[model samples]
Target chain A: MDLHQLWTIVSTPDNVPIVLLLFVVPFYAWYGLRQAFANDRLIAQLEGNPEMAKTHHRKIQPFKAGWTREVHVWPYLLRIEFLAAIIVTVILMVWSITLNAPLEEPSNPTLTMNPSKAPWYFLGLQEMLVYFDPWIAGVVMPSLIIVGLMVIPYIDANPLGNGYYTYKQRKFSILTFIFGFIVLWVSMIVIGTLIRGPGWMWFWPGTTWDHNRLIFEVNRDLPDLFGIAGRAGKIIFGAVVVGAYFLAAAVLIHKLITKTAFNRKIYARMSVLQYVTMQVFLIIMLSLPVKILARQLFRIKYVWVTPWFNI
Target chain B: MPETNGNDGKPAPPAAPAAGNGNGAGNGGKVAAVVAGAKAVKTRAVEEMKGAIKAPEKTDLWKSVLRVKHDETPRSRALGVLSNVFLHLHPAKVNRDAVAYNYTWGMGGMTFYVYITLVFTGTLLMFYYHPSKVVAFRDILYLDSDVPFGKLLRNMHRWGAHLMVIMVELHMFRVFLTGSYKKPREFNWVVGVLLLVLTLLLSFTGYLLPDDQLGFWAVTVGTNMARATPLLGHGGPFGPQMGMTPFNDVRFGLLGGSIVDSNALLRAYIWHCVAIPIIASAFMVVHFWRVRKDGGISGPAPVVLESEIKEPRKI
Candidate 1:
């Protein structure tokens, strides 16, 4: 029950659980090395039938494989990943017992716990929700992230190399998702400390974000989208923009007799891919700018608010 | 396309001049045909490779599933499973695929490998880890420094738990940027998301096992989050609102467990140590099987380096 007893038990060398893992890890490592070496030899022998060696088909041709060559993985990656994981584990274990986070109590519920937080690992998840609505942070964003992860193999089109891609291949998407996340959270934390005037993001007439009500707003706001005037305005404006697009074309066609070097048939065919790309880009850009413009352009900018980080 | 006839210069087997001749390019359109012909052969070759490598499905009565056959020694049995189903988890099977930059090893293998370690070490810890605060913390300490293999077991469990989270996330990231979920596999993506949530829950619940101050308060915070989830917690519909699921209500009914104490400990223990593992593992098998179904081992299609590819000779 005392700290000394705890230390003694933990420090003792004979502990079954800890010792077993130690042996098992090296055992696995040895097994890995042996397998790697044997595979090297096996591959050399199988070089006469390169196809058979390349694929994992169980069928073996017992021909006299007289011709031979050497091929093996250089700087084996599996070994590295395994080693990294092991190193991380050893570090975490050492840290767990060695580093105590200023322990407060023996877990008495009667006494209020101060600054209670989840384990360090789950903190990432909790921290993530700060940028998103509750439904999104708590549910949808994590869900989308996982779903997006699962489908990566099917989605990416870079051919030639299969499993050899690195962390940087799709850095834009990753950085966007992560930065969007951190910004969402850091914005709240900073705003929580500083911004406080009226509405969650607004100082009475001006609109922005308030840190405290972020979770509540996100979790609560989206569902009420169409039911409220604010949400209806978004829908209405979105509809109008789309409608205006088609109407503008109709007017342009009526007002001007447009001609091109190509015939009408070629013009329509040539323009399709370009049109789609432009439309997609336009839709994404239109969202916030339209919102700001619709606000009657009367709002003053807060010196600290980055437009993207605005809310 | 054909060699000149001894009597007259003409293509032989005109119906299919290239079909049975060397230098069949003399035939009409033969250059285009020959180039296209090589591509056709390659496509078939890939299909052939696929046919050869396809793991026999369980439905095949003739070919039994690869299993840890009982007759083998414990080590062989272990190796056998390790080579096949568990092969991806460990680092033993590196080949050309290992360094193929596009063939990067994702966290799937690491996740499962750590999982294997956890199972190996967890089963051992169950022999020593008590679920109660009265003895749980002490028992863990005893395992750490007292038991002959205690340190290894504890580290394995501890490290395995920690690594599983990291690897799963890496696995998620690998899957994501690769755009693997684009087509014919969206539902599996959903399943994977569920698996992610399950993994987080597993980690959260498992953290409560030690009963130390850190573990204790972690559960308090986590359970508090659960309570805030609109249904079960002390402040929820059941408390102020009176909402509780069958899994919790019937289970914890006898004990008026408002806080993360003994009753909460048992609930978390069942989830952490028992229920989650069984479910997560079953789902893992499904995950593996589905991968096989969706097309085993997804990544970019193989691109043999031009330096490595050889030009076949004309027969």
Candidate 2:
């Protein structure tokens, strides 16, 4: 193991945030789920006891009979805000003092950064370029992500978890979000930032980023593997494959959505428009992982290839 | 009563000692009267000054500046938030549990605080920076070595930006997990998503300001993606057929040139420093306002039981 190589990557100032992210994301996920499960237990209790349900405050937060339901913002909420601001300031000051921001030599067009990477936040999209074309990875995926996020509230017809954290009530939505955010978005960023190295090649942590490393693996398109020679025939074959994947994914998602009675109730409430929009976004989201697996397992470059575009 | 006092045309002093010399006595009496008048005035001034010190808040200047009496009373406490322009964004009171750190994680507020820090540090950095390719790299070097606290300023701005992005993502994650985006909050979530995009764009634009190889190549890789933006980019699918070229595509508009160069630096500077901030501020106003309007925060609210689930309203 090249401990020096691993240390060099981790010590890079720009990589610090990703290192922080690696810990922060999982800690928060666990923290949130802990609360979720607590609330779920409470929900189960309240569900079992109709007598307590009628009189209960319904919140897990302690509430005595005489306690005020609200508190003054002056010392209560504002103080927390003030404390948070001070804490953040201290953190920023210490960070700025300790680590100098990275600055390289004067920009020269003639000399390119071996593994030119975008900002850490956009690293996920950068990683997607390996699996899909730039048009899809860079342009279409980002736009779709923003739109999909915006459409979430409108599409989520489940009303049980409206104002609270509860796993039982929001299992489907929560799981879907975790898959999209933690599994796909954040993991891709982690890969792009830490794993992808010189020449945009995968270099596992502790492995030296060899500048001249080469792998003889050949990538082939699905059409080529199927022995389709004619251009029109390849295009037709690719279109069918992509369409079939979407169709199959949609069916699978439908089965998952209606697996339980409560889920079916929520699903039944969604309008046809909401349902379709949700399915389109879900299928598209699932496509990323499928494409990633395909490339990793089979070395497939593109499933669909045409003169105009390839997917 | 005396013959001399009548001749002088003066009133008698009740307790003044009579002087034998005529001109000397008259002058001494006049001086005594003046001294008495001064002592009385001094005593009155002392009393007034003591009163003022006792209740400075009751003074006109304090009342005018504060516009409210700040006392320990709950009314005054509520007014403390409602009356101040800066704190008025918050309600007078909040749900008791909302004050707890566990529920919201305070990420939203922290993110805003970091953004404010960035703005402050950015404005300071701008004083020492020029957006020309010729001087940009040199300015950074100068900032590092020459300008007082300049390296720290740049470091804070850079790190604060990264922090803001992380906080924004975390805030969104919290909101989603809590199902805070449901019902009336849907639109605010949309606004928030836009703010997220703006935050990323803001950070990306600032990356090019240093004009060093790190920033230059990072931006080149970033904008290179734009070159593959569907029909708008020159190299994108169907872009060539649409008459797009290196000189007349979306990327050209973004960088003000075909490549990352002097024009790109200037463009990034303008967008980073001027345009995007104004736009993001506008969205933030809407986002915060909607938060209050859409029912404060989505809870640590009492969990809604599945049995209590109401029928969904038909759209």
What is the TM-score of chain A, computed separately for every candidate? 0.33, 0.99
Off by over 4 Å in 2: B1-43
What interface RMSD does every candidate have?
Answer: 10.4, 0.8
Give candidate 1's error at residue B14 in angstroms: 73
Q: Per-prediction TM-score, please?
A: 0.47, 0.95
Residue B68 C-alpha lDDT in model 1: 39
lDDT per residue, candidate 2, B1-315, as tens digits?
A: 333433332334423333322224477766765665554445555555555687889888889999999999999999989999999989988889888887899999999999999999999999999999989999999999999999999999999999999899999999998889988899999999999999999999999999988899999999998889889999899999888899999999999999999999999999999999999999999999999998897777877788887775554
How much is A308 displaced in model 2, in angstroms?
1.1
> Which pairs clash inside model 2?
none
Range of the 10 consecutive residues with the lowest summed lDDT in candidate 1 chain A: A300-309
* Candidate 1 positional error at A187, Å: 12
Cα lDDT for residue A97, candidate 1? 52
